[model samples]
Target chain A: MPTLIRAEGLTKYYRRPRRYEGAFGGLRTLITRQYDEVRAVDGVDFTVSDGELVGYLGPNGAGKSTTIKMMTGVLVPTGGLIEVDGTAPWRDREKNAMHIGVVFGQRSQLWWDLPLVDSFTLLGKMYRMSEADYRRRLDGFIDLLDLGPFLDRPVRQLSLGQRMRGDLAAAMLHEPSILYLDEPTIGLDAVARDRMRDFIAEMNRESGTTIVLTTHDLVDVEALCNRVVFIDKGRVLYDGSVVDLKATYAPHRTLVVQLASGFTAARAAELLGPEVPGDVIADEGPTLRIRFEANRISAQEIISAVTSRCPVTDLSLVEPELEDVMRTLYGNRTIAV
Target chain B: MNAGQATCSDGPLRNLPAYLQIVRGRLRIAMTYRQNALFMLAVVILQIFILRKVWTALYGEAGVVNGVALADVLVYLTIANLQSWAMQDLAVGSYLYSLVREGRIAFDILRPAGFVPQMLAHLVGGTLSMVLFATAALPLVALVGTLGPPASSAAFGYWLLSLFFAFGISMLLNLIVGLGAFWTTEIGAFGMLFTLVSQFLAGALIPLYFFPDWLRTVAELLPFQATTFTPVAMYGGQLAGSEAVQAIGIQLLWIVLLAGAVRLIWSRALHRIVVQGG
Candidate 1:
């Protein structure tokens, strides 16, 4: 796939007036010429190809939204080269806007006082969409996203979930080739979140719409993104497959077993012998928790070895949580993965 | 996909229809609050009553003051007040300020249409609705005060042309003030100051004819007078023939200058946002 978005050494710096505190601070700040500089996005480089749903993952204040803003043509980079669909976004904003759809989770682009459908109609006109095309797309979105119930209701009156759905439909109504979703699932409930994820996945699958989603929710990344680009402190930390990220950051899997009354964890460990590579710990009464790397020793081998030696009432395998893996990644910036 | 692929050309003329739709949308939203229009009409009517009483009392036993007839002065005051009430749209400034404050300007920046054009459309749409409400108050205006025809057909034609320029000048001025939000982030004080200064100087509260020679000269020198006084005076026959044409010409010049200022300030504002992450 060809690269649809690219950033090379992209940087954005903000210079804010130095804020003072305590007595006479406001007066001093008013007259002061000094400014403090913040590097919002520092030397970031990444590429997103066509037809790829890449998760632009970051923690709070990680410059994820800043990067997205620059990509969406709302902000001009202070330094370095960035392009969307072969055009410098800030230089040609309207042209860039025509081929891309953007949704910021914190704000809705819909007109506040008008019925939800009115925003669509206005956007259709703004985008210069043909009447037939607009109607067909609107009907399809209404069916797919279940927007019919509140289509005529004012946008300000809709629930958060309903409004978010409306926003999603609005963004995609023009059928842009690329969609940038900044924290799209920020405040959604389980059912709404699931529906959102499903819709995003379907859009990527059916229309081949390249999506760059920035989210704190690991589930959204796990459910929709095949490739993930992790950034923190205004720099790209890791860019690769989610499975590989987990393997690199968190390699261990745990096998939990509940032994029969007569069997103890010690006895189970002894029976497994040194051939099976793993550590078995005594859990709550008559239970053993075995930790092992899948590459070094498979969970099946360990479970079979333990079951053959000692009678087990129940057993389960626990894979590492992506959230924990991300925590570890965010906690230690020095870990080169 | 074809819709997405449609090439967007940049220019006001090409996007006129889209901008008109935006204007229509804003007008519809403003009309949603029907009570607000009625309230405005009531306020204007009450204001007219007070003004008529004051002017009548002041004109006591004098059919004319400063060579201007009482009837013409009443007509001028009525039209001036109505124009002031109808075109009183600080929406552009307040809207820009709030959108910037809440960081919701990203939506504006992301539209295929230019931000300034969209905002101008909004300003016009809001003013159009107010003009509608003002039209509804016309009957009351006639009953409460003098509402006479223009001095002549020529005068009426010049007044119409001058009013168009007045609208342009006012909207552009509001836009310039609104762009201040990009720098200050709070335009409430600025907007209030603009309203007070423009309303007083534009002859909305008091006609330029009432001002002393020095004060009238000062008001005439400024663009505010072009927004209200020029059109009102022409309609009242206070300015006629060459004088009326010159006043309209002055309004056109102000529009040109104010439009240039708006463009310059708008570009700078965009630069500020781009650099500062607005």
Candidate 2:
């Protein structure tokens, strides 16, 4: 796959108005013309290849949205370079818009009072989609997203899950080369989120659409994205495979060992002995839970150590939760990417 | 892949069809809100009726006030109301303002469609819908009031031309005011102030000729007068031949200038688009 989207030192600095002290502060800020320069997106660089699903993750005010805005050409960068399919997004916005589809989760691009299909019709005209292509695409999305029950209803009348499904379908209706989704799964139920993740994965797999998703939902990242790009304080902290991110930030993995009936905490700890540096999390009768850093003690060694001494009935190894990894990454310490 | 062909690769000209689609959608929405349009028409007619009574008592059988005749003034007022209905797009300004405040303007900006033209088409569609409603309801109102025809077919032609340009100028002005949301959160305040000023200057509430000499000069200096006063005056024959042509020329100039101003202000506003509410 070739690089379809690229950014080098893309920056956006906002000159926010200064507020004064007192009841008249808001009013005074209007006339004072005082502004404070805030760097919303500092120098950040990344490249996404065609058909790759990359998650852009960050804490609140971490410049994730600013970067997405610049990528989508909603905001012109104060400095540095960005190219979507070889065209600078801000420099040639209309041309760049032609090749990309964007969905801002909290906002609906669909017309509020109009029927859902009417919005699609307008989008068809906007994207210049052929009538046959439009119908075919709409039918596919309707079937896949289960949007048939309320396609004729006004968007304002749909439930949040239904609205989100509608929004996703509308965003994909244009069939652009790149899709930028800012929190596409925000505020969705488990089933809806899973369904959305499935559709997003299908979009990339079947259509080869380059997916750049910014989401707070780690499940979305874990389920859909193969690569993760972590950003904080307007900087990229990490960018690599999701497994690598978990390995680098969160080393501990849990091995839940269910021993044969009749095992105590002392007995379980003794059975594992001094060879393994695993923390015995719990010893509930026959079930034993141990957590150990994967780098220090491999799961194979721990399983071997436990099974050789104790009667093992069942065993399962749990990977470090992506949420824990994200929490650790979002903390105040900077980790070199 | 057919990505390039599938998208809006035809360049900026594509805004034309997209704008037409938006207009169609907007017109449909306007139709859905028919009751609101009818209620507004009732308010405007009531206003016209009260003003007609006031003007009648003031003229007192002589049927002329200052230099304008009563019949001409009545025609001017009715036509002004209709022109005002056609040209006004307060809903667009409010919509734009809310979009700014809510940070949903990003969607509007991200599309391949040209932003200014898209917004203009939306307003034009809604205005057209409102105009259609007013036209349909006019006959019922005509039974209560009397209005004369335009001075001549040529005058009526000029009036139509003026009216189109006037609508352009009006939409542009409202857009400019809405763009002020970038600078301040008081967009609603600005919208109200703009409506008050435009209504008076455009002579939607009272004819510009009825204003004092200094006020009329002030009103004439602004673009609002072109939206209602110019078309209405031309229709009533108060402006004819060279004057009618000049009035239209002024409207055209305002359209060009206001369009330019909107473009300039819009570019600046985009720089300050703080996606509020995150």
The superposed Cα distance between candidate 1 and the true structure at residue A248, in angstroms, equals 0.7
TM-score for each of the candidates: 0.93, 0.92
* Residue-wise C-alpha lDDT for candidate 2, range B54-83, written one tens digit per residue: 777878879667798887887777778766
lDDT of 2: 0.83
B-chain TM-score, every candidate? 0.91, 0.92
Give the residue spans of candidate 1 off by over 4 A: A262-283, A308-311, A333-337, B1-12, B60-63, B274-278
Tens digits of per-residue lDDT for model 2, A213-294: 9999987888888998888878889999999998998999999888776776568777667777878866557778888999
The 10-residue segment of model 2 chain A with minimum total lDDT is A328-337
Steric clash pairs (candidate 2): none
lDDT of 1 by residue, B1-278 (tens): 24543335555576776777788887888788768778877887888778888988999999988898888888988898888777778765788887888788988898888899899998898888888888887998899877999988888998899988898888888888888888887877777788888888999778898899999989988999998889999897888999988888888899889889988998988887842232
